[model samples]
Each structure stands twice: as structure tokens, then as C-alpha cells.
Target: MIKILAVGDVIGRPGRQALQVGLAKVRESMTPDFIIVNGENSAGGFGITRKIFDDFINSCGVDCVTMGNHWMDKRDIYEFRDHPQIVLPANMSNVDDPAKGLRILESKSGVRVAVMNLLGKVFMKGENSCPFAMVDKMLDLTPSYVKVRLLDVHAEATSEKQGLGQYLAGRLSAVYGTHSHVPTADERILKNHTGFVTDLGMTGPYDSVIGIDPDSAVRRLRTGEKRNFEPAKNDLWFYGMLFEINEDSGACTGVHRLRFPAKDS
Candidate 1:
């Protein structure tokens, strides 16, 4: 069995620190063969920076980093988007976007693992293509040798996520949702062996509103004013999912949720 670790969105500094503190424990306990993290918000609750990306890979030992709608919020990303460890959404309508949406990586056990990022349009505002079609194209583009495939569906609507998960049931090893920042209770393996989860939740402060400072988030919602959003500092936690896949068949045999609170600073 190949153990795969999928971490949720990292909010900001606190989130990074939480990973710095908790990832080692997870690694020691679970010993995952591959580690993938949603790093769209790793910079400052907006987008990821090159320095932060390096920290995730070099310091936190992340093998792959996936992004979401906030993929372009930081300027440094343009310089590092070509990095093999990072990937943006595949369905982006902007043909000029240079970042790749799908990537195939080799795990520690020499298994080829295909990872793809996709965006949902149910309630999102963006010029993106159909996620269903994009996924199909990505699967076709992936080499036949790669059997362990994972998709990060960064979307707002649960229905869209569930639909995509069901659509790719027998083809993918796992289908996980992000962007919601709130973890869901439903996690199961479909009859076809695809592991599914609506949302993996955020790996940042849990005491605030989806990693944002509660006061600022409330002000923007209540007064309709644009306020500088900051990442929350309290109640730090690390949220993710652990998957056990059969290497030969590329079928998920176990799906486990991981929620670890950060040590008191």
C-alpha cells in the first residue's frame, strides 16, 4: 500500500508555522510515501510566494503543491510557476496562463502519481472551462503508466465537488475538495475504489473565520467595505487527509482524516 498525505489550504504565517510544528509528527507517525498540500493562500491569506513555496518543500517536506483561485494573488508566483512541484488549475479559460494544471510526479516508492488541479463554476466568478471536461482531458493526457491519480477540486459548491467525485469514481485514486476551508464529515471510498471528501479544511487558525481575522471578516461582511484581511493567529491546527492505495491496482483502500492542533506557542 502507498500512503498519500493531502494537506488542506495553508492560510498564512501561522499556517506555515503549524505545518512546521505538526508535519514532522505526522510524518513520524504515518510515514506517507507522498505529501501534497494546497498552498494557494500560503503567502498572507491571499497567495503563495516563492519563499513560502520553498519552505513548504524544503522545510515542511511537501512533495507537491496545488493551487486554487488565489493562485495568482502573488507576483512571485509567475517566476516559480514552472517549478515541477507546483501546479495551478487546469480549467482556467485564460489560454495565456503559463502555469501547468496537471503534473505527474514520482513517489518515494518510485510510483508515478498524477496530480491535477481543477476549478468549479457553480457559484464561482471566473472564466473557466467545464471542470468535468477538463478532468477528462487531463486523464487522457496523463500517461497510461501513471495509475495513482489525485484531483484537487477547489470549489465553493458542495454539489459540484460531489458531482466531480462521482464522475471520476473508477478512474482516480482520490478526489478531494478545497477552498471551503471548513472540513466536512463525509469521507468514504466509492464502490469503484475512489476515495472522496467534500473538503479537507484549512491548515491554519480555527478560531477565526476561515483563517481570516474574525473582526476584519465581519467588518467586510457587515459594512461592505474592503478591509485588509489578516490571517488569524489563535487556535492553530493542521487539517488534511491520509490515503492508503494499492500500488498495483491504484485503488484506494483506506481514507483517514487528519486534524492535529498546533502546540501552544
Candidate 2:
């Protein structure tokens, strides 16, 4: 059996702070073979920065980091386009995007796991190919040695996330959603031993607006104004999921949501 710690979006400062505080403990308790985190909003609550990505890996001890729509907000990320550790959306390169969609990592036990990143179309713009179709091609091209295939599907629509889970139910090891910053209640092993979840939630302040300052989010919502939302300053929390896989078949044996108590600051 191989244990993988798959986490949701890590927002701005508060998110970073949460990881800084709890990651080591989580690693010790979970004893995962690998750790994959979503760093799409690891930057300033909107995008990820190189420094943040490095911190997630070096400081937080993440084995792989996947991204979402906000990934493109940082133009400088293109420099690490070819880096094999960071996984971007598969369809992001439809018109010559630089990042790669999926990443594969091999553990010392000879288990190969593929982490694929994709974006849903329910509420997002069309800047690439169809995610459903992209996933199909990716699965077809997956190497035979890789038995554990997991997907991080980032989208705003719950329907889209559910649809993707249904679409990939029997074909993959797991399919998880991100970008919402709040965890869903669905965490289960599908019919074919595939794990699925509507969303893994965010790894930041539980009291804020998706990890941002509540006041700013409210102002923008009420006034239709654009403002810089800062990371929240109270009740920080960390959220993610853990999947236990059968090494021989790469099938998921169990799935569970992991949450650290919210910290009041």
C-alpha cells in the first residue's frame, strides 16, 4: 500500500502560515509516501509565486504541486514551464501556453503515481481544449508502469466537478476538485476502487472569504468593485484529503478528509 497526501488550494499569507505551522505535523501523522498540494492561489490570494512554490516544496515538504486558473496570473511562472515537479492544466497550452498539465513521480517502493491537473468549463473562460477530452487522451497515453492516476480538477461549478467525477469514475485512482477553498462533504471510494470528492477545500483561514479578507470580498460583491483582497487574519485552518492506494493495482483502498483545527489569531 502507498499513502498519498493530496491537499486543496493554498491561498495567500494565511494559507502559507497554516502550512508553515501544520505541514510537519501532518507529515509525521499521515506518514504518506508522497504529498501533492494545490498552489494555485499561493501568491497574493490570486496567483502563485515562485517563492511560494519553493516554500511549498522545501518548507512544507510537498512532493508535487498542482495549479488552477489563477496559475496564469503570474507571468513569471513561465520560466519554470518545463519543470517536471509542478503540474499545470492540460488544456492551458491550447494557444501556446508554457506549463505542462500532468506530472509523474516514482517512489522508492517502485510505485508510479501520475498527478493530472485540469480546469472545468462551467464558470471559467475557454482558453484551451475540452478538459473531458483532454483527460481521455491523457489516460490513453499513461505509461503502463504507472498504476496510480489522480486528477485535480479545478472549477467553480459543483455540477461540473460531479460530472467529472462521474466521467472518470472507473478509469482512474482518484478525482478531486479544488478552487472553492471550502471542502465538500463527499469523500468516497467509487465502484472500481476509485476515490472521488467534489472539492478538497482551501488551506487557509476558515473565517475569511475563501482565504481572503471578508470585508474586501463583501465590498467587491456589493459594489461590483475591484479591490485587492488581503489574506484573512483570523481563524486559520488547513484542509486536504488522504488517499490510500493498493500498490499492485494502483487502486484506491480508502479516502478521508484531513482537517486541522482552525487557529484563532
Candidate 3:
């Protein structure tokens, strides 16, 4: 079996710290062959810095990282088309942007795994391409050696994620949603052995509003003020998923959630 860990969105410093603190234990307990994390919000709850991206892979034990709509929040990433650890959002127009959406990694056991990053058209801020068509093109681009396919479907609409999962049920090994900080209750293997979920939640402070300081978030909600944001340092929690894959066929055998309970006294 080839086990793979798929982590949810990382929001700011709190998320990074939570992953840093708990990932080693997760790796030891699960013994996964590969680890993937979504780092769209890894920097300051908006976009990732190159250093934070590197830290995600080096210190957090992540094999590959995906992004969401906030992938372009940092102006520095305007030239980040060549970053090694990131799988750029696929739905973004390639006519002007210098980023691509898919990547393939070879596990130590020789299993060729394909990870795809895609943005949805519902409730997203930026202009996006046709997800269905892009996914079709991605399927065609997969080399023969690739046995497993995983998708990080970054979207806000649960209907969209569910529809996509149904569409690609028998073809892809797994499909997961990101962007939402709260995880969905649905985590299970499809009839065709494909794993699916609405969202993977987040790795960050559990006590705050999506990893921000509670006072600031509440103030923003109540008074509509944009105060200087800081990642909440207290009461951390980590969220993600783990999958057991068939080594030969690359189909998922089992799927489970990886949750680090909130530290509250």
C-alpha cells in the first residue's frame, strides 16, 4: 500500500506553527509514502511567501503543495511561475499568467502520482477557466507511467465539488475541496475506490476566526474595520486527510481524516 497525506489550507503563522508542531507525529503514526498540503494562505492569511513555501516542504514534511484563489495575493508571485513546490491553480488564464496547474511526482516505490490544482467558478474572486475542460485536458496530459491521480478542487460551492467528484469518480484516485476553513463531515471511498470530500478544513488556530486574532475578526465583522491582522497564537488545531492506495493500480483502498484536537483548557 502507498499511503498519501493530503492536508487542508494553512492560514498564516498559526497554521504553519501547527503543522510544524504536529506533522512529525502524523508522519510517524501514518507512515505515509507522500504528503501534500495546500499553502494558499501560508504567509499572512492571504498568500504564500517563497520562504514559507520552502518551509512547508522542508520542515512540515509536505511532498507537494496546492493553492487556492488567494494564490496570487502576493505581488512577488507575479514572477513565481517557476516555483518548485507549488502546483499553480489550473483554472487561471494561462494567456497572461505564467503558471501551470498540474504536477507529477514519483514515489520511492516507483508509483507515478499526478496531483492537479484547479479553481472553481463559483464565489471566487478572479477570472477562471472552464474547470471541466481543463480537467479533461489534464487527463489527456498524464503520461502512461502515472498510475494515481489526485485533485485539489479549490471551490466555495459544495455542489460543484460534489458534481466534479461524481464526474471523475472512477477515473481519479481522490478529489478534495479547499478554501473553507471548516471541514465537511463526508470523507469516504467511492464505489470505484476513489476518495472524496467537500473540504479538508484548515491547519491553524482553532479559537480564532479562520486563524486570525478573534478580536480583530470580530471587530471587522461588527464595525467593518480592516485592522492589522495577526495570526492567533493560542489554541492551535491541525486538519487534513490520509489515504491508503493500492500500490499496483494506484486506486484508494481506504481514507480517513487527520485531526489534531484543539488545545483548550
Quick one: best lDDT, which candidate? 1
- Of candidates 3 and 2, the better by TM-score: 2
Where model 3 places Cα greater than 4 Å from the true spot, the runs are 94-99, 262-265
lDDT of candidate 1 at residue 125, scale 0 to 100: 80
Shift in Å, residue 20, candidate 1: 1.4
Instruction: Kindly provide the TM-score of model 2 when superposed on the true structure, using C-alpha atoms.
Output: 0.93
Deviation in Å, model 1, residue 220 alpha carbon: 0.5
Candidate 1, residue 218: lDDT: 94
The order by descending TM-score is 1, 2, 3
Query: For candidate 3, lDDT tens digit of each residue in 81-172?
Result: 46665788887764223236778887656777889888878887667777888888888888756878899998989989888888888788
Local distance difference test, candidate 2: 0.81
Per-residue CA lDDT of candidate 1, range 134-242, in tens?
8888887888878899999999999999999999998999999999999998999987689999999999999899999999999989998768789988999999999
Find the 10 residues in a row with the least total lDDT in model 2: 91-100
Candidate achieving higher lDDT, 1 or 3: 1
Q: Determine which window of 10 residues in candidate 1 has minimal summed lDDT.
A: 92-101
- lDDT per prediction? 0.90, 0.81, 0.81
